[model samples]
Target: MSNPAPAEAPTGAGTAPVPHRDTEEPAFPAAADRSQWRYRPRRAFWRSRVVRAVAVVTVLAICALFILGLVREQTGTEGFLVGLGLAVLPVPLLMAAFRWLDRVEPGPWKNLLFAFAWGAFAAALVAILANSFAVRWIATATADPDSADTLGATVIAPVVEESAKAAAILLLFLFRRKHFGGLVDGVVIAGFTATGFAFTENILYLGNAFGEDQEFGSTGLGSVTAATFFVRVVMSPFAHPLFTVLTGIGFGFAALAPRGKRLRRVLLPLAGLLLAMGLHAAWNGSATFGGPLAFYAVYGALMVPAFGLLTWLAVWSRQRELRTISGELPAYAAAGWLSPAEPTALSSMRARQVARAFAARTYGPAAARAVGEYESFATTLAFLRDRARRGTAGPDFPAREQELLHHLWQRREVASPALTYAARATGRVWAPPQYLDYDGYNPYRR
Candidate 1:
């Protein structure tokens, strides 16, 4: 979805600020007429110092519930160990996958878990309740026509299960709209929710497979179970992510899309959801057919394309920042706040990384980190500029937004012990000498 329009200034407050069009001028924070503001585990609690306490408690409670279930079942040694193994292996991988794709501003760990926990708890509960009845009703109506178990598996699970899982994305939109900055952010959030759902769902499937194996003898089910696991968990873990990302995209569009473009906001995410459902349905259909042709058709026609499209979109979204920097740095350099060579160096992603690494080399680890932060903030500003160009904003209306964002860069630059401030008395050697002069400071004579 698109970004929103710039806020209009009050009648007495002079002209409203216009967000800039496509030129790559660094959006220095112009002014804020107004200011605004996983999963893992049992072990996920320990990943960070701050959240560790709550995470630990949450994990223990989950573990206790599982342990109690085992105790009540009076699971034999083999059964219990099988259940435990089935449960634990996926947890680390699920968490690691979330961590892997979460390169964007690392989001609220609590929110990640909220998505995950919702899937694990609410989705399952609701699916069981709703589908239980639907299955029974359908069976009676059709005299086992729909087959209750099949209905639960095919129909109820996708809708109720997906909606409950997607509720996490909705919650993120409701509470932390700012976090849902763009489509990619939406993708990440969607992805986490999916990961959470898949993690929990896999446990049942995998656990059942194990339980069945013990009760009925292997009968080659280990291979069948492993194959399903590979397809669902390994091949394209994006299945759940794909579904919930639609909600995330909707939320992002709602917060950011231009004033009159609300229709697009509604439509785009719905389209994404439709696409997701189609993929889910196709996969189900193919699996239902259960032959080599079905396998090849599902993988070739549906799964691969979905995976490729999302991958392309993610990369395309990421490249905009680089392109924007390439476009805007000249304007900043002309303003004398950015040096000539520096702008070129920071324009490309590779170059920006090099520049960041260069700062690290010259200044040290702290400077490197500073450069990284500065680049991130700068890249985001460029993205906003692009959004504004597409009429996401009113006009070049957000002069203050530019100024505040620039102020962040300024602080980041200051944090970089290696590189000196650009708009200072001293000048770089290779560039033509320039001077900084504003209302208070004058470097030119009348």
Candidate 2:
């Protein structure tokens, strides 16, 4: 019996029209015979997208400018310049590390950029203002400045800062829910937010240190600037990211929960946020509660171990994503939506790399790009299907699945042969079971 055909794309006010197909064609039509599907989003859709884009950009830009002015006012021009230079050193490295972790099912750069900008400007601005106000209010109430400072750092700062950073994750989780799939996505987005926050924090600290050093006629290695750099930049660059990632993990878990399980969805993120706050408070109180020894003890006993564990969890989650792709795509393969070998090739990072390289070598950069897009769409499709099976998929699942299939179909000519070649080259080729019907019963459904 011939394999069952995949669902046709649904047409609507904003969606593209379904392409015509010959009734006599096979379930998986020949590459040349498959009609190319074009997505022509309606003018209203384009207008709304552009308007939202502009609004977000404008808000971020305004926040950035205000924060820049505030920092400059506090730190002299020269100090700001020095701080900026030093503060930027670890940013690219941190971003690269997070992006690398997200490689399996890479998110759009726009999400990452939004996370970073939100943390660096919007969140930072909120933290600084709210923290200062809280400290002053406590100082006035208690008539003890030092104690107010301590409480602000340990209690007030953690709550405010973590909440501010979490707003970015929360917004994305609600609005860009489709992209916020699982734990790794959470970790990556949280890491980017924390990295950006740390970047701005470092600049302020370093700039103030530089100003102090200038006032005291100190320079070189023995200066306040050097000490600040060594402590904040060299020693604890990952501190903020580690704290924020806990919150991200919480949101990630919540994302995986079925919509009907409302309590699980709410409690998971709250728990994550609480954990993040506790850790942040402990780290901040270290200096006040003890001294340098206490700081080192916390770093070694808590921070380092926490970081390592999260790192392992993130990596394991990425591997599980690949496994999910490998497992879930076979049903589609058996139904002729995908080539028999495509799932195996797409699941292996090495095979994927080889496929892209082969495409570029044979058909140039455009073909390579097509293959990359095809891979992304296929990976997303697998995740979407997995969510559907788990009863966690959103109302848009059918439309989204059809859109992904259309994109995959468009690029199959460039992607399929290269994937097949890479599968054989990498020794990962597999023959999907010929008679499996997903609609009736799927062994791989779980």
Candidate 3:
């Protein structure tokens, strides 16, 4: 028999009263019940307000310095402006692609913002300085500046740049642990970080290329600037993001690793980083082996296949996430916390979109936002329950699960009917029969 939970002592002004057993528990405790009153949350170092403020200030300072350095190094303010404008062209497209991949359980905007900032600012700055120094040192030792530049690009640059980009993923995995769940999340975060890094690097290269064009009196389509833009922008926008995504995938596996598998958790991300660095090195070194034709051959043969494979992997992972939601949320539905058709609706991206649109149409944009929040919370709740079932849940699992349930309950009046309608409208076979009249079922009308 399990031990009874400790009783709380009663209070009075004159004397101590008799203690009474508090024999209560949540309907789904998720794990064995413990005296929750004694469970205080652990305070982490980064949670401190002062630490957070200092970290923000430090990152801002780094970004400022990097921007200033880029402007100074590029020369000719006109070229810098042109490069800045041109470099930004691919960013939104890349971001949209990653965001689409993460639609099943979109991560927090703050995490994505941090990844971008860290890549564009901190990572880029470190790469630039470290690569410059390393290349110079190699030139001095080898006494062949041309060969040194090749070495810098193929060897030093890849390691420096990929490691710098991976730092953003590492930080998120460590600090924003909740949001760094599974493969899609890892790929999305890494892709955004790499995109930002590429954006800054593109500005530098394009600006320098433009400066070279101005030196040679070349203009228009035949110029070095045009070639750089075509190569970096048009031909291979996904180059940097593709390389860094390996590292992110590694971190993703690490995140999904069961607790206590310390070796797997540590080694997987490292292996991913090494693979990223190797791929980046191969891409850089390609040009050295032969002419542009050779580089293109490697690109078509290796890079294209790798990209296609990773894309498939990311899509497959998203499908798996949807299946997990479909499989897990039915328990909550049975518990009456969610509608019978809600799990099926939540699993379909098309249904989710329809639900949000329906919510907006019925009760304005605020209702749509509530519906979106409900979806996120419900998805999270499903994942949490899945984790609990697998015995990998942390101490706060019950609290977090309850919190998500509470959010869903608050928004259910609007979200439920919308989702139910969505399931029916989308022609999902599992859609509950009663939900066909969802419009007439006013849940809030007590």
Among the numbered candidates, top lDDT falls to 2
- Estimate, for each residue in 1-446, the C-alpha lDDT of model 3 and write its tens digit: 23222222212111111112122322332332333432345457888646885887687577758665765566568788888899999999999999999999889887887788888888888888898899899999999999899889999999999999999899889878878778998999999999989988888888888888889999999999999999999989999999999999999999888776889999999999999999999998888867798899989999999999999999999999999999888877765677788999999999999999988988999999999999998999777666655545565664565556556767888999888878878888443354343447532332
Per-candidate Cα RMSD to the true structure, in Å, reads 9.9, 7.2, 7.9
TM-score of 3: 0.87
> Over the stretch 195-214, how does candidate 1's per-residue lDDT look in tens digits?
65666555556566556666
**The candidate that achieves the highest TM-score relative to the unseen native structure:** 2
List clashing residue pairs in candidate 3: none
Instruction: Give stretches of model 1 more than 4 Å off.
Output: 1-117, 219-225, 243-256, 289-293, 328-330, 341-343, 388-446
Off by over 4 Å in 3: 1-46, 49-54, 430-446
- For all candidates in order, the CA lDDT equals 0.56, 0.86, 0.82
- Each model's TM-score, in the order given? 0.68, 0.88, 0.87
Candidate 1 global Cα RMSD: 9.9
- Arranged by lDDT with the best first, the candidates are 2, 3, 1
Error of 1 at 223 (Å): 4.9
How badly does each model clash, as a count of residue pairs?
28, 0, 0
Of the pair 2 and 3, which is ahead by lDDT? Answer: 2
